[model samples]
Target: MNQPSTPASWRMWLASGQPRTLGIIAQTISTVISLMCALLFLAIAFGWYMDPLLALHLFLGAILCLAFIHRTGNPLGTKNMTFAGALLALLSIACCGYLVFEQGRLSERLPVLDPLTDLDLVVSVVLLILVLEATRRCIGMTLVVLVSVFLMYGIWGDQIDGPFYHRALSLEEMADHLVFTTEGLFGPALDVAALLVFVFVIFGALFDRFGGGNFFHDIAQSLVGNQHGAPAKVSVISSALYGSVSGSPTADVVTTGSFTIPLMVRDGFSKVRASAIEAAASTGGSLLPPVMGSAAFLMSDFTGIAYSEIIIAAVFPAVFYFFCVYMSVNNHAMRHNLGASNKNQLPRFWHVLRKDWAYLVPLITIIWAVLALNRPAFAAALACLGMLPVFLTKSQYRQGFFKNLIKGLAKGVERVILVGVACAAAGLVVGTLSMTDLTGKISSAMFALASGSYVLTIITAVAVIVILGMGMPVPAVYALSAVLAAPALIALGTDVLSAHLFIVYFCALSAITPPVAVAAFAAASISGSNPMVIAVTACRIGLIAFIIPLIFLIRPELLLQGSPTDIIATITSTLIGCWALSGVTEGYLLGHLSKASRWLLAILTALIFIANSWISLAIGLCTLIFIYARRHQAQR
Candidate 1:
């Protein structure tokens, strides 16, 4: 009998390096042949006789990768489970691949008709449902249930309630749209995933091998780790590092929270405070640039914006967000009388730098390449890989080069699995919406409810984003918002970039909001705090998230939408706005604020920030000064 499969965590590799595991990983010889056969037949059936073998090969490659992943316990599978999963995964690949290849090949010859063939129709529907289920198993039951509801609406539209109700499409039509066309399921979402998202995943993995994590941690430590609230600040910086690479808030929290949360607690931070700080900071990572929480690429494909522009647009908001979190931690430190680092106790900055200086070069090179070249994700991946040799030359880190390399690659691939599936599953959502014109209905209804009030429209849109974000990750959150709320933003006369980024910011903030806060959940697991308490604190600390979106919505120039002077003005004003807002939220400037002063400053700062006029900025500054003077006098 075959040995049992292991879990996908690091511990599993240590427990068993069994030979069978490798074969299972390779999906054995028989499984590969079966998958290849499936693809060959699929290609022939699709009338791709001219390039039958080539199409079959691509399909086979997809299937083999799918089978290897399934067999590796990467998904919820075992040895026996692998055999069946490999077969099913192979079949699904063949079906989807043939559909894509055939569609391309037939475009010039003949238009592929609805429910093109009986075989195609049945396989597409079956495979779609399977993909959804696979996504549910890997991510959560929430998205599956959500998509199921959508499918139900399409099938039973006449019976549904509310303005959302409409005549339903037949099952055949639904399947045909979802599987065969770009409108339904086999759409840009999946295309972006297959092409762009995977490369970034590899890029992120390569960064890790180049000691990107250590570089981030050391830099954060050197800069902020000696402050009064050093641990909290470190959490912010480290989360940014992980966020830029991982692109998931929950993943960021898990990666950095274990170290930072314990450090914060040991250094006299409350469990709730420490966990909240980490949670809020980690969630902000998705909003950070270069990697930007993984939505920039998707946003580009969906909105026709440049990827570099998304990165540029996100830079200030992300900075403002982390600044707010840092301020919260600073205020907490002051309130609790947390002491600053003892010079003798703190690690020597120069020593830390000298020790790991080489590790830092790769990250710098990556950022330079991205901004300077404006190249694709693959270019970034190549740059990162090219820099790895320099990092490996360090004597201390050299011993584990190969080990880290493999681990990073494996982790990166594993990270992409659920995300890849989520995108595919979201294709179902996008596919259904496009096919049924459900987005138009939702948008029109949202508009009717707002009745031309921009504020009300924004409120409703944000509420939807927050609600959707609770059960989904950032990509899915943005996907749902892009489908539903984006049109609402466009209708309000907002720039397309600002509108989508606004939706994305709100969706990203949800990871720190109450109820189903994934980041807070991860932090709380380590800090032993009540998840809700941590989540509420996280929301408070991440207040800039709420404000920045409003800023971009009001002043689209903030998203790098204007001339050079306009861009400079927007950035300057936004930075000042952030400072004032941070001061207000902390209830401190020169000293602690009185209750009245805090409220006044908060109101004035928001007014000025949103007003975006010089006069408003001047008045806001005066109020800030007044608060500071009053606090200074009281302290004296």
Candidate 2:
């Protein structure tokens, strides 16, 4: 008979046949590196001053080392370092070390003015190659390929004979701009990743580890778990709350969907519908406030906007996105007669609050720090510190407090690897664009293609952003979209915040968009449904997300950019419009909607979304009210 499995045996299995000593050594090094990285960022957040580029190099080096040891494609797996990975890890450290060591000299040197020494060139080239490889390993080839294409353009675009051609940089110029200057690898993207995104990720990881995840789930269950389609509603509420902190749709799906999807399926939700609902809800989390996904922080860096304003602007749209999902799930549950969960099967609200109420303080602390204090990094750090007391509240957590803290640090660092690499890689793309003026050319071409029509230009820009978002992480997608598409929208007279947020929405939606929907595919493994089917269903459920951006773009009132009365009116119309759209998507509102009724609702949704005056709002509102009234009377 086979022996029962233990954690030690599981570790051995995950090591993939590596020698026991080697595996142990790799794990030790990984843990040490994780702690060092976390502490490094924490120190900075608490006002430790270091040269920004030096700090970024140290952070990137640590991430690359972690990426090599942790193995690609398996985030939660044990360290399985091989000879090749070990060699690459050493090279990463050496290259990054040289930069950190020479930061003082490099900082004083001007790009294209001071020539790079032979050693400088070698380090630059080696570091670039290591970043590319680490990016491929951590994020996959989509970003690697995109960065490679930009690097090539930086080298050879001058030889091309089209609208896209630009002056090329020589080998030395390329190396100097990309490596020696802050314009390239150590640019805003990586800077934000190293500074803001890392601390927030740490806070999120610790918050979840120290009972926040359970609190959110229990609260969601208490609110809706005994209602019709309780599982699906629970998924939405829990995911939104968790995703707001996690800032990763795919991670959120894996975390919440593991419990929610199974419950949904057991409760008679179709596997595809269950997976799709979870995917849609999780994807919206990155769009939620306070500690949104890494990309939102990058948006703040790129646009020079305050992080607080970005979250505030995002509130209405994010809430509406979840509202639409809730409505769709409710309609589905009602339409199919899905049974309500037994009250005894769910956690009691008061009991959960009494037990886990402390978990909420960190979240409240972070939000207050960001919104009131206007210091996002400081807020996140304080939240991380605040989680310490919460861990002590539980006897189980207290017994292993230090162990769990180390694990949370390691996990948070592991999570930051993807964003760090993506940001570093995106730096290459942004560097190339800045050097080559590709952003201008693309924006001009898009304008010309749209015949100077603002609406057409916006349409063309959205298509470009969505296409670029496919098979890419949100940070990379937003980076590319901001450079490639946001310029066109801005040039077409869109507000800077709205243009970037527009890019953010679609980049996020790409995770649930068909063909390459990463979040949907993540749900597929749990729900045992076809990934494509889940993607399609997710799009239907998240239909309002796709429309919300366009609505806000046309009428900024929805984004809280108008007078109080205007904001109120726009929100009211949008709520009604979203209700109509939800009904159209799920084929139920007051009751099952007929084909004609769906079509009518669809038209009303369009009118409401495009409403530019009170008359338009009045018409749509009255029609929606009449339809609901008529349906209620018919049912009677």
Candidate 3:
């Protein structure tokens, strides 16, 4: 009898190494571990009996192991494991395993009251090192260095003479606080990551695996592929849809930009402008509602706000963000006289809907479950489960269903390791800040520096968030900002929700900010343009994003915090302001604008956005009308 054939995935796994059996075993073990961890979180989401600490320990352990196995080196370049990586992976297992077995006993021991045993101390120290190392490997040195600074501060803070100084912490005290207690590596940040964020990541991974991405792209193309500037508009719509679920702007650019950027260039846009447009559009995805990025989940956890409430409040700002992008693209298309896409090449809207409409059910399930049922984690879990029937309905998905399920689950776990490790690292920062009372000191320093001016405080916070966000991921940036700058904003009389949302806005924007614009860089790779040029163009295209956060900060009604009339009025004025700003930025309204007209429009837009009163609104209207008449007379 002929030997049975190995599965394609198994063959693919074994193709990476010299020892076939070893590769098979390693792949099997990793897949099993990932699945088991995923199932554990799923069970916990369904109210399974497990200690929260144990769950976090399991999550951190498996993620660290996977991180070491999949990535090597400090800057995280290599995808294959080396001997050193294997050793680190083993160490991660042993260290985390100790806590996993002893979690119950450790949980009952009062932190700082009960002295740790030698082995306990050893495990704590090793686990802390492993977390930092894994963070360095998976995320990069930026976060690792930030976490290290916090650790060093926790150790020698008492030696400092300034107001920032705090009481000294011993090695054992630091280890116990960060490793043994829930306040450190196992805090709300990790808790949220292990449960809420992980489930959503799985949902997104499986959704993409099962053709939701194609469905979204097709739908967008069908809707706008025949319009002028069709490619850029498709990038905005598709990236917004995908980014809502994928939640990573860089990943969104890589996924959708591969198609949209080339199309934009083919249509008429410059390579740099095309890349920048995609980057800006993808960056806005995290701010979109229904299903937002992982940082939004962190926001819900950090602010004690419901996920549904956050998404609901995000509606106006998110809409206005896309509106600005769309208006900018429309003007550019008009200016360049870009023609509509070939009608024959566009997908039929009804045909796409009729065929792939089932893909939307999972997304709708998430929105309904979160809003109607108020169970965000369960909502994500249900969406993942809901994908099965939808997958079964399609022959391509139904074939090799079991293998695809395994592959999707494993890929989901792998994809989340960066986020998981980042959250754990963020926990270290939060733990240190809490232990040292550094957050209060920083907030006080900021307050004094701003001299009790809320606008100045906001500006300072924005600068800090964007700078911190430069090389860091959104989760880390938001976590750091939430603890540091947000407290300052709240102290200066900003609303709690607004302050946190303000931090989130800047965090997302940093992906396109210059010097280290991750999203723009990713787009440049596809567009074959200079990354900095793309970053500059993206900043111009996304200028409205920077302003929208400030608008909501001034008018809380923009976040749905006021009466119906107030909400409506704020949204209307902001939309008009965004339109005028887009005109100023693009130098095109009814026609190409002269420098004088652009300046006049810019001033009126500033007046409208800054004053937020009837007089400003009337003046803005008159200015717009005057500009329109002048342009019309010129056209005649």
| Every model: Cα RMSD to truth | 6.8, 5.1, 6.4
Q: lDDT of candidate 2?
A: 0.86
Count of backbone clashes for each model? 3, 0, 0
Whole-model lDDT for model 3 versus the true structure? Answer: 0.85
Top-lDDT structure, candidate number: 2
Q: Tell me how far the alpha carbon of residue 489 in candidate 3 is from the true structure, in angstroms, after superposition.
A: 0.9
The CA lDDT at 499 in model 1 is: 90
- Residue-wise C-alpha lDDT for candidate 1, range 112-143, written one tens digit per residue: 35335677677777677667646655556677
Clashing pairs in 2: none
TM-score of 3: 0.94
lDDT of 2 by residue, 1-636 (tens): 988978886544333221122367888898899999999899999889987878988998898777776654333433355677889889999899998888888888888998999999999999999888887667666677789998999899999999888876799999888887888898888888899999999988888877788889999999998889999999999999999999999999999999999999999999999999999999999889876677788899889998899999999999999999999999999999998899887889999988887787787788888889988899999989888669778888899999989999988998888788888898999898889989899889999999999989988987888888776778878888899998889887899999999999999999999788989989998977899999999999999998999988988988899898888888888888877778888888888887887887788788888877475579677867867786988778
The alpha-carbon lDDT assigned to residue 349 of candidate 3 equals 94
Deviation (Å) of 441 in candidate 3? 0.5
* Model 1 stretches with alpha carbons more than 4 Å out: 1-115, 158-168, 345-353, 396-403, 562-573
Better model by TM-score: candidate 1 vs candidate 3: 3
Tens digit per residue, CA lDDT, model 3, 447-481: 89889988788888888898888766788788889
| Model 3 spans > 4 angstroms off | 1-25, 74-79
Q: Which ten residues in a row are the worst by lDDT in model 1?
A: 11-20
TM of each candidate vs. truth: 0.85, 0.95, 0.94
